[model samples]
Target: MEPVPLAVGLAALLGLSSAVLEVHVGQTSVVSIKGQQAILPLWYTSYSNSRPFVSCLLERRDPTKHLQVLTYIDGKSKVDEKYFKHRVGFLYPMPSPNVSIAINNTQEDDSGQYMCTVNLGDESSTDGRNIGLVNLTVLVPPSSPTCKIQGTPHVGGNVTMSCKSLSGKPSPMYHWRRTGPSFQVFFAPVQDLSKGTLTLTNLTTDMSGTYICNASNSAGYSNCTITLEVTPAFNAAVVAGAVVGALIGLGLILLFALQMFVYRRKKKDVQEEMANEIKEDAVAPKTLSWAKSPGSDVVSKNGTLSSMNTAQDHKLYPSKPPSDTASVTTATGSMVAYKPPYNNPRGGTLTPTPSLSSQSLPLYFPPTVNGIHCHHANVPVHRNAQHRTNGAQPQAPRQEHTLPPGLTSSTLTRMGAVPVMVPAQSQAGSLV
Candidate 1:
């Protein structure tokens, strides 16, 4: 009895007339367990690209009519029961020219040995030296790792996470990897690297994830995926403190500006008050002082022409405005106008009669060089300032004159007031 071939898989050739699946096929092939259904891929043993492939027709070699076509696999032989039982196609013409084995409806269990042999026939003659071997050990991901999580301590603190509940023999190789990405692995047990713990010294948002612990021994590999779920340590308390501090600083700045404004306002008010006082003092009216004079400039003895001086500087002086009293309505009316005897002509000056023009106060003062000959003293000094008018000082009133010893005796009677003559003894006493 000849031995059956250890492999059964697809075979292809560029141009071949006869039906013979004789080339070394790849570990993964296009095979279907149920007609027109699905396909399965095997990852391990691969075909050599250097050789050409050929697929043999099954009905040409089936010695018994009971023999049916079936396929097989290599590493995943434990999952091969479905591929043996499912019907594929019937053999019609012996040694048919082209027989295409279309793949359909495949599952993980359809991964192993299949055959095209006669039922109750010699098993040795059914398979040949060019065996059909498919390496179909499929990958099965382990359960999700169950573990607790904690937040990162501080900004610069380190963090770590562990993977648990992995099965198999040889104390499986632990590879710390993360899913949702293909990263350069930091640890793989085949490379004699680190174990389950993944440590990050300075933790940040980039360090969090669903970590894939690739645990593998000889019993085939699996992945225990755990999520680290790292959270940031920054909080609201620190930000609030900064805002409060800024507000306090702004308040201090506003208070300082207000104080400066108040100080300037007060200083300007004081300056304005001082300026007003200076202006009042400058325009106040003052008395005029004159020296003793010769001739008409000398004083006269008339108690009526008082030389008054005010005791106060700010005393009020009201003067009659131009429109206060009536004026001469006509020159003819002036001849009958009311007049005062006090507005008479000066002493030593005889009036023939009052003229129409010279009504009162005749010879108010004659224009002279630097002097006036007054036969009377004018207004008295040492009186209240109410007598002053506008800013003008009051002129002294006329006085009655007394004749000198040498003048004629009638001169004394003509003058209404007397001259203030001091006795020679009194003058001598003043000089002493």
Candidate 2:
């Protein structure tokens, strides 16, 4: 037969697509580092009742070498000691029916095509067996990338940037960026982009800063940065004016901040002073007044006022109320109206008349209207009692102050009592 392509010839000789037996291996190459184990994945199926034989081989085109690495037949291994030694073996041995193998401590020289074959006794020959193939390649990380600018870096100028990394398996991807304050990264303006080059057109003053290039792959990544300074000619007078204006603005801001600070401080101090005044008012003792009415704001003398004890010896007679009669009507058939002493022309002041007793105490009447008194006097206890029995000093006759004919005692009590002095003889004493 005419010689066939290696792949087609191998498939035809091994009958890999036969219905009686099937073999499988990696459709793509397997990658591994030097000094590391690599698996040449394989599997097979045989319709024979008895376990079939299996073998694995390596083919290298560059060195023109073909080597059988693994074999199993009749419950025993017949390995190639010259090529594999202890470096190759079936991952799953016979009786279990697995055919994959492991290549131990692989090297650059081990990179080649791997083949697996399965044979059924009496039905399959060595040249007509099932087959599979796997290929492997090792990889290495790339070196640091070199970044550079190819044109003058100035305002409104065009520039070209390039990035490259050396010695990496597979290749590396390139990315161009600018590094800003706080380590922020931004993409450069792109006019044209290619494998390892970037073109920036119509550069502005804002584009002047640090630029970076990064290259990455499945193996590793590398980066580099370049400082770009764009110097644009400017008028000296314009620059000076801008600097002066900025300085003035800064000074104004500082002055305004100082004024606000002072205002806030003063406001806080004033609040503190007001708080202290309120606290002092709350803690100070209040002055007491005997004449002060409840809920009234009027100021009065501080001494205690006296009260009368009607149960002792005196009899209180209430005059007719304002609604009962136009004026007070007395037992003597006289009508007298009572009014407040505060509005009196006499200023409610009392002047002593003739002495009522040896004590020489003055008796005063509050403002009266038409002979009707606003207050009742305290009757002396010595008066109106039985004459002194068994040598008691002769008792004084009680003076009578009669009330109107229709007035009741209950009405007198509700009208309120006037403060008064009592006689020295009474044991009940004065009320206060």
- In the predicted model 2, the residue pairs found to clash are 14-129, 384-398
The residue ranges of model 1 lying beyond 4 angstroms of the native Cα positions read 1-105, 118-159, 163-196, 201-432
> TM-score for each prediction?
0.23, 0.37
Model 1, clash count?
A: 52
Q: In model 1, how large is the Cα lDDT of residue 161?
A: 57
- What overall lDDT, based on C-alpha atoms, would model 2 receive against the true structure? 0.56
Question: Model 1: per-residue lDDT, tens digit, 287-387?
Answer: 33321222113232221122221112102221111221223222233323333222223323322111122221211222233465332322223232355
- In model 2, the worst 10-residue window by lDDT is 298-307
Q: What is the per-residue lDDT of model 2 for residues 255-371, given as tens digits with 9 covering 90 to 100?
A: 999999999999999999999999988866544332243311211121121121222222332211112112222223232223322122433322111111223222423334466
Residue 49 in candidate 2, Cα distance off native in Å? 9.3
